[model samples]
Target chain A: MIFDLVIYVLIGIGLFFNILAGIGLLRFPDVYTRLHAGTKCTTFGSIFLIGSVILLGLKMWWEKDTNGSVLALHSALALVAILLTNPVGAHAIARAAHRSGIKPAQAVIDELSEEPMNVTTDERRGGD
Target chain B: MIDVYSTYLIVVIALSFCVILAIVRVLRGPTAPDRVVGVDTINTIVIVSMVAFGTAFREIIYIDVAIVYALLSFISTLFIAKYLQGGEF
Candidate 1:
């Protein structure tokens, strides 16, 4: 009974975040900002959503269901895959946006590009 | 026992709304990266919803399908980003 309630809560939380992410994608301006909505929220939501599945599997296992073990283990692997890939994909998209000449909304200067140039300058001065 | 059919039905409906919103963003996005991000969001949501449905149905195969979908989606996102950046292959 308790586990069922917990699963409900987790699903509720996860669904809420995922919905927020979708809205963020629609409402936020620019690529990077949209990414803030699109990437982070969904990833966080997946943590909860998938976590519920993991808990379910554990619940089954506790009840001595043989399939519970496999379900829990597989769900964990899927969660790991999501954890690993989602952020990296987001980062890559952000970098691509910057490189492809898509500037942020109301931004000043790009510090990332300048940082490399600054490093080169320091190296040149040190050589002198 | 939980009523999974109803539970997942609601969840799927909610996520479909999200996907529609993302599609709106994709359609109206001012820039190319904007569209790409919209597409990426859509992809993520789709994968999660798939997993949710899998659990609702208690299907092991759907879980593996979700994992594979995630991997393929990641690779596609990376490639699209690379294309956008105009970086070497």
Candidate 2:
């Protein structure tokens, strides 16, 4: 009984934050700000979402259901996949946005602007 | 026991909310890459939801689909980044 309650609560909490992530994405200004809202918020929410699934699976497994064990284990793998990939993907997107000339909102300084040009001829060709 | 149908309904509704939020970003994003980020977030959220649905429905196949989706999305993200970096393929 207690376990089911805990699962329900965890799922609810996860759902709440996932919705918040969407809201933040809508409300934030600029690409970077929106990325901040969209990526980090969803990642945090997914932890709980998947965590709840893990709990559910474990419960099923404890009930001696073979399929339940597999589901739980596989869901855990999926969670790990999300945790590893989401941040890396976010970083890539942010870097790409920066390189593609999407400047941060209300920015006063860009320290990377001081770096000397390192563009090879190949890059110059590719840029065309 | 809590009603299983209710759990699935809540999960679907919550995920739909997320997808709609991402749609706003994709539509309003000023830059191409911003839209890409929105899409990527959507992809991640969908994967999680797929797993949730799989568990709720007692179907393992959906979980497998989620796994594949995660990997393919990662590759797509990398390719997009490479394109933005102006690097050779």
| Top lDDT hit | 1
The residue-by-residue lDDT of candidate 1 on B52-89, one tens digit each, is 78777878788899889999999999999999899589
Clashes of each: 0, 0
Candidate 1 residue spans exceeding 4 A from truth:
A113-128, B1-6
lDDT of 1 by residue, A69-92 (tens): 877888788889899999999999
Candidate 2 residue pairs in clash (backbone atoms < 3 Å) = none
TM-score of every model? 0.89, 0.89
Error in Å for residue A124 of model 1: 21
Worst 10 residues of 1 chain A by lDDT: A112-121
- By TM-score, the best candidate is 1
Per-candidate RMSD vs. true structure? 3.5, 7.3
lDDT of 1: 0.86
Tens-place lDDT digits, model 2, residues A17-49: 888888887787777777787778888888888
Error of 2 at A37 (Å): 1.5
Tell me how large the interface RMSD of candidate 2 is.
1.2
